[model samples]
Target: MDNQALSLNNTIVATNANVLSMLSERGKNIFFPKLGILAQAAQARGKAINATIGEAVEDDGSSMHLPEFDALVNMPTANIFPYAPSFGKPEFRSLWKDSIYRKNPSLKETVISNPIATNGLTHGLSMAAYLFANEDDTVLLSNHYWENYNLIFENNYGATVETFELFANGGFNVADFGKKLNEIEGEKIITLLNFPNNPAGYTPLVSEIATIVAEIKKVADKGKKVIVLIDDAYFGLVYEENVFTESIFVELANLSENVLAVKLDGPTKEDYVWGFRVGFITYAIKGGTAELYEALENKTAGAVRGNISNISQLSQSMLFKVYSAPTYEQSKKEKFDILKGRYDILRDALSNPKYAEYFSPLPFNSGYFMCVEPKKGLVAEEIRKHLLEKYSTGVIVLGSVIRLAFSAVPQAKLPELVENIYNACVDLDK
Candidate 1:
């Protein structure tokens, strides 16, 4: 055998021999960071405020009253028990596609494929990673991204992540983004964009969104294949009037063939059904065909078949009924208003002068959570533990930033929650 061939064989065996090494190089290096301990302890301790989980809750801290969706659970027999197609129920796929475009009317002229169902938005991203990226391929993401993306893209798919600073001057950093895209020359790239972003909870302004679409087109114009995945998991939850209201996918879909736009979204956050696990992946390739979509759908279905086989039938059935109902619009608005109330209360409370001594809030105009960078070199992990043990308040701490999911916190409780956080930081200073 050739010397190079023998060396490659030896490396493969060494990697497979160590069970941990079977994971991609990136996976072997991850620490599986967790901060759910506070949530768990809060439950056991009782009356502990939970600012951890992102689900919406009632004023008394109970789960949101979703009487409107009760009928979804009692669907006709065929909807409940039988297995669904690996791709999804055809009607559900069509309905989801219609719903997406209906909400974002600017996409009416764009060439886009029908939506394909997955277990959740997370699985949709995983499927996209499997299809577009290969071992050691680079994925450009913002530095402040959801933690799960690491496991899905890098660990499982063996892709390497390249990060650009997510914020500059309190907005999207277009110049830095363009620089990063140009730096890695002559490679087909996969770039991920998440709006109503997790942890930070900021969506781009209209001008920023336009720049993002233009930037990807420039990359594609340079003859490099660019797959842009838009993670719109927290779609349409914006609380501000000035922020861009639609998915940037609409403009991107109309761009060059070299750029493929894949949108990952679901009813989990939109419909307030966190446990439903019903999400979709829709693609757009200019001048693409039904046959092309079918081919792409088959590969995604094969992945789902080999793994979970299919998403839960009951979940899809429930979502279908919810989508089909005439009252769905009104029901969603009711829940949105509730979340908006909580969002506004938190915004107002954070504006209090007293809290400024502890931390400064980041740019947050939408979504479930808002992040803060603590003052005085305070460590987020230490403050998290101090808040849990001393004040019985639970918040998610990521590195030096602290994230509070106001969606789960009642409007009436906002003042107290802010007070506890202030106290926690002051006590830690001593």
Candidate 2:
């Protein structure tokens, strides 16, 4: 390991030995290069004769850019053209961290590191995998999880994915989850909890979340270290009354000395900025201090530096501006209301008794999608193909379930979409 990496590992070990033990070999070896070119350039920031930076700048230190491109975006040239800090733009990171507290009031007293920017949630997940997932290590996930998780955790890092049924009895299968955690044969446990889950769009009830937390705590109490990655990509999109609106991160953050909660979320899904590709990763551990969090941040920054160099400065700058606007909150609420309207329409349409014989709708209350499993030996893929060919409707087929992204459909069209899906299932069954 580099001297810097060793220093970071030592810092983490001093603060929490359990956290240090949970790190992958790569995590323990990665460190932000403070003595390199970026460091030197930062040191020369205010010097009269500064030339350490690589970007083209005018004598006055203004970023050189094409007038055509500059006219396209209203942001200052410096904000778009300059390379962002590997950890992210500091001001934007601070603002986003503040927003997390605003969004999850339960996290008010939790000690979490400032958020680090990434290309998107996928990048954030990859970063977490780099830091913690090792070859052959067991990673617990729900069977109804986003498929990309396998590519990131198993394919990229060689971690073995162990899955539990996502739902049972029309709700989160808390019992199955506990059973999976108990079945793991190691001292370090890594699991992902994605609320408003990708395909099912189900956010657990508060009591269910409490039970989940208790199950994780049980593992921690057994002298095991736990790393829980909370993917809140579709956060703040709950359309129902009884859902656990606050992130599960809040509950897990202060749960145990052996538990490290990493939150991956961003504007990509939450703010309706799919093309912006901006996301953040944050860290929280029990008994955490500023120094300990800073060390973790430095190590994560090093991973960012090594992998993608940094997140897009233009996207970060644009989002920062959007966040600063006074109308930002209202604009977000408007979009949320629109999506919630679609969710309501889809839910109502799915409730029709006529569709019950074709397929069964899964429990869903929030987020962009809902899934249904074809009934009576009907294959989901066959139903998907029938829908596409016969009705010109498109939906994703994941094993035994078909996923519908109701958020993309207009409120008026949602009923038609659901009806077509039911018709397709009926056609396939015939």
Candidate 3:
């Protein structure tokens, strides 16, 4: 149909506000497409979410855990045998809140009372999508971001994702981040920033976080609610001089009533309990008392009720044990140091002349993965395939860039592992 004809056929409802229009417009794109990885996951196939979503089943053996994988997942009896609350176990939520606020003492008095638990980071992400996203509201995101965020913000919530590149050449891009803020004028937008990124592992420095707040303030100055969702999946793993805590979470609160910060983070990446899958949604509503907190909590619970029903009872039960454990921080800190050790080795080896010339590190402070923008002629996939097929090594490809998970490989094996990547690239050059 012609543009004029299409316009003729559509009637604008007088009461349909700009927010609704924005929501409708944004709901039409593929920001985050669901991955086939879940098709292979037991929970995806299990009665839990499977029954509701009605996705096709893979097989029955999935019900019985594979022996080797089962052994690694050895949780205390409570974690395995019991059920958990939908929101979260009370004590677990309280302890988890203590873990969050205690990390940032500057905000000991800051009231962030409502914390909703999810099965994992993804669950909290999806819940955020469900809660704030309108029919097609724009969810502004960092240019280089976690892929799965697209699925939650765009695919599921009916939101359009806008972006600004977070960094360049191993440093933060404050100007670019500011420019993106200037571009938005009307409509409700939820701007999300993920740190210790999935592919890049870029954590903004303290100055960078301050700069981000200043930029966000410019937007909120225009009377818009800046719902800045911070995905802190990899927390307490800071290996560099970076702004690592509730800086934005605290700053956003002081900025405006229009500024509501939703922090989507969890235990999946934190406790070395990947399979345990416990996460939480924390709201940082500045200057709000019990009444405001209650209202927000009610809405948050409504979002949980509408979307997920509740986080797993079993996951919550187990997390409570970890919460109550005396060695929680000490044990967790040791694990973080271990992942940190692996990252250090990769960082040191990446400084090698041979590999250093091949790529530049995007601003990375801490996280499992790091991205490399291939120099000149090398395509990310081609090099990735070359590495995998010939060297029997694996790496993830992101557009023209390649992402390496240095944290997963053992610290002792990092030298040899990097050598494999280095050698593969050299062969490609030849």
Winning candidate number (lDDT): 2
Candidate 3 error regions (>4 Å): 1-83, 242-247
lDDT per residue as tens, model 2, 1-430: 6898999889988889888888999998999888888778888989888878788888667898777896688877888888898999999999999999999999988889989998899999999999999999999998988999999999999998999998999999999999999899888999999988998999999778899999999999998899999999999999988899999999988899999999999999999898888999999988988988998899899999999999889999999999999999999899888998888888889889988888888899999999998888888888888888999999999988999999888999888988898777777767
What local distance difference test score does each model get? 0.77, 0.91, 0.68
lDDT assessment of candidate 3: 0.68
Residue 166's lDDT within candidate 1 is 81
By TM-score, rank the candidates, best first.
2, 1, 3
Q: Kindly give the number of clashing pairs for every candidate.
A: 0, 0, 7
Q: Of models 1 and 2, which has the larger TM-score?
A: 2
Angstrom error of the Cα, residue 193, model 2: value is 0.4
Candidates in order, TM-scores: namely 0.82, 0.98, 0.80
Worst 10 residues of 3 by lDDT: 25-34
For residue 58, model 1's alpha carbon misses the true position, in angstroms, by: 43
Clashes of 2: 0
lDDT of 1 by residue, 59-164 (tens): 7655554566556556654576556777889999998888888989998867577787888998998977766667988889887789999999889888888988
lDDT of 1 at 61: 57
